[model samples]
Target: MNMMSMSKLSLLSVLLIAHCSTAASDLPKDVFILAGQSNMAGRGGVSSGKWSGDVPPECKPDPSILRLNAKLSWEVAHEPLHSDIDVGKTCGVGPGMAFANEVRLRANESKIGVVGLVPCAVGGTKISDWEKGTRLYSELLRRAHVSVSGGGVIRAILWYQGESDTVKKEDAQAYQGKMKKFIMDLRSDLNNPSLLFVQVAIASGEGRFVDSVRKAQLGINLPFVKCVDAKGLRLKDDHLHLTTMSEVHLGIKLAHAFLTTLK
Candidate 1:
């Protein structure tokens, strides 16, 4: 090749390398998917029995954490983290916001780019729904891909479900296998072998087969899969959902598990 052509090629290579490096540095590395049922979506401060309340201070919105909004776009994450997916009643505070805040505190947003939370929880859903090929499952996969498509990496999946499954003995009994399969499928599809899947054991007042679901949740014995206890947490007056304080505590537990096991 001519000297000028060779010089141009070398310059192009250097410029390409520089661009790639800058992009890599700019992209985020801590995108977490918070998916599950109502509790995972949060019903804190929303009274159903008799009393009403407001969102507490700890679980308020944060500027550092970004959530995938209903428009399928990223924006400042706030309460009702699953606003888009929560189609039933209005969305409320679940453990998601608190969890993201804790992660931000630990990850040090100033150093890393930011924490991106992908909320995909729907109220009153069953484990049967989130299996591999169902609509919810497909949507979760699609959202997860689109979420990290912006260049961030999927750090973990915060999963809290099975309340609906607990209604039927059969569903509760079958939860362990279904849940195990769901985790395997999620990891396989995401292509993250060591992905962190944190499952929050169900709280009380949800159903008659709560124990069965709890056993199944705890029974999901797999590497990189951790379980957090929510059996005795304070529940809302409805006796089905968690109170704001309990939700915050649950978020703390989830965050601790995520930060500790993630290596």
Candidate 2:
């Protein structure tokens, strides 16, 4: 072979090797996207060993889903409390742990190992704040893409927002349209038309808009989307957040929804 031909061949061989290596890397067999407002962000106190048996060695808890050199690490999701904010004395755990545990349990027969959870929940965020094509949504999509690129296959999205939108009656009707658009955009961005969405209905409360938002969330009839009711679950004194026990209960409830999808 001539020098130029030999060089071209070598380059092609290098490219093929790189591609094979990436393909061979152990990507997450399952990936879960956890997103929403304050409740999803979690307000309950942190408990040690809450996820003792189920946590995969590779999975660690980090608030912010920070990516470095195409790899992800965890960081605290909240800091520099705003002036108007009230930091609940107790930190409430949300559904992420329970969901992971459920996956481990259900996958016991198959023994699927190391489920990756990408939690990007922010407190006090409105449904409108999750708008597609916006900076916030763009960041979310970017993180998701990176996670997938890093060998994580996104299997589902867990949403727990709507209180803010529900409080404003005028915005309730438009929620359905907004939610539909968000789902479509999410699927398109992720290139996964069948992405599973497990939504948590706003728990029963004093607010008038809660029921409206729940109804709207349930109204979206897209395939692979299901809503889990949190009405009966006991919430915190603020009448918004879930207590530790309630959080665990909520998590189990979410796990049930996820299992249903698997079936």
- Number of clashes in every candidate structure? 2, 6
**Given candidate 1, what's the lDDT at residue 211?**
90
Per-model TM-score, in order, reads: 0.85, 0.74
Q: What would the TM-score be for candidate 2 when compared with the true structure?
A: 0.74
What does candidate 1's lDDT look like per residue over 1-263, in tens digits? 99999999999999999998975554446788989888888787675422243666767777667888767777777776765678776667788878877777777623435788888998888999999989999999998998888678887899988889877888889999999989999999999888889999988635799998898888887999999999889987778888888999899899888877645
RMSD of each: 5.8, 7.5
Model 2 is weakest, by summed lDDT over 10 consecutive residues, at 77-86
Measure candidate 1: CA RMSD.
5.8
